[model samples]
Target: MSAITVIINPYANRGDSQHQIDAGLQALATSGLAFDIQLTEYRGHGAELAEAAARNGAEIIVAAGGDGTVHEVANGILRAAEGSEGVASATLGILPVGSGNDFAWGLGLDKGVDLAIDRLRRGQTRIIDVGYVEAEGFPAHYVVNILGGGFDSQVNIEAHKIMRLRGFAIYIVAVLKTLVIYYRNPHATIRFNDETHEFDMLMTFVANGPRLGGGFIAAPHARHDDGLFDICLVHKTTRRDMLLMIPKFMRGAHLNHPKVTMARAARVEIESPEGFPSQADGEIVGNDVRRMVVSLVPQRLRVIV
Candidate 1:
């Protein structure tokens, strides 16, 4: 068997990921890497392929798509590890061939197939923290980058509806659309680090990395190896206030805003009487999420840098 397994999501980048995949495959071939390629046929197929590859003793499972693909592949690897030693036997790699390559960007990876393949050839790896989140009516899953609930998740949903744009522009348009169409913030109770905060929340973002939505610096100080999550809570505010905060987030300068609360924690619990939407690594986890428990797992996954 090949030492590397590449899971490609053909539907990434709004269904235009084929060119990137082809380029990545060519680079891998030229790099003298012994690898097997698998294309995802449906939504969660990447995870299934990754799990099977790990179970079969693949040394590396490369996610050759976007952040959603990375999310699935990581979940699969962790799941496979749970059956054996509770430690991932397969390392993870990323080819940022998607709209929002937030996780890859946070890892300091350049935005080219050749560059990604070069990193894979170098074979440098690091152990990074992973987040495990469980919510009502949703399967417990792993988050390798960030999870956003409430208004942030609604923006993600709107972003997916857009077809003409790519990258950060899509998220910008989505944010505008969400404000007009979905503005009701949920009443949330958040518990973390022996403190409970109750408020009408606009959103709650937990970050294992410093960025999301392509370029939004959600947690500029976050580090994947830190064994803790940087949490951002935005209190319910007017649409005008949200609009004013957008530029601040773009600059990673919103932490000091009066409506924003930023802290670091290893575990967090959130509940709401009004069910909310949530997305992890750009994949929508659930729409009617009433409760969520998130905890960090230190040094859980090995990743190629």
Candidate 2:
């Protein structure tokens, strides 16, 4: 029952997170800080533990795994603050022991356990924006890094099936697998910043940070505290065209591609005639959602840098 709670996802990074737990906790102990640990036993367990901790008035709740872990912890903290007045949101800290620590990478927590612990001990925090998605049949989800629909969501699905590869390579292989297995794009109407656009799109991602899947620079100009989401639209294109664009995304040069559209907005509405797959922070949120609204909550989450 310490003030700082650390939620660890045992299966994250293919179980490497569990293996690294000792060293991570040892570092925290060496920092002379009192804390408590909670191990997630199943999907979404992190959020459950985090929510309980935040409600109990934990000052700092740390996600001791990867991006998915961070997403859950953030959501739990956000949910606890809902309808509660004059309560400061729990601060989030990352230990970054997962495979694709893209969100942690953006927060400068990818350096390893010791550095992340040092960051926590220093107590310097940044207030950052987080995105929320509301759709029928699904509870609201918080997107701390990126929320991707269509092609990228399909890629995430494929990536989950891959067992041997780790880190960025898994996403790279999944992208190739997606091209061969799921190539059809969906027609979507997107409204944001007082403008409307309708077209067949391969993918649309609303980003709070610059990277996804460990290395892909999906939104190169994104920032977490900007109070807006960086939205990228990938227009439908031939397989050959998609293959060519992959490299550009790696370096974040795809922003200028003729088929790609980049814009910043505080909120966005997406609707598709054909249902499309969607994911938030690398976790599949829905497989056949026809509509959803993504809006930025400005300076909502506090994170230890």
The lDDT leader among the candidates is: 1
Model 1 ranges with Cα > 4 A deviation: 83-86
**Model 2: residues >4 Å from true position, as ranges?**
85-88
* Every candidate's lDDT: 0.91, 0.89
Q: Which ten residues in a row have the lowest lDDT in candidate 1?
A: 80-89
Q: Per-residue lDDT of 1-305 in model 2, one digit per residue for the tens?
A: 79799998888888756657788898889889999989999889899999999999899999988889999999999888888643347999898988899998887778888888889999999888888899667888888899999999999988899988777888999999999999568899999999999999899999999999878999988999888899999999999999999999989999889999999999999999798999999999989888999998887888999
lDDT (10s digit) by residue, model 1, range 103-171: 999898746888899999999998899999999889999999999999989999999899998778999
RMSD, one per candidate, in order:
1.1, 1.2
lDDT of model 2 at residue 132? 81
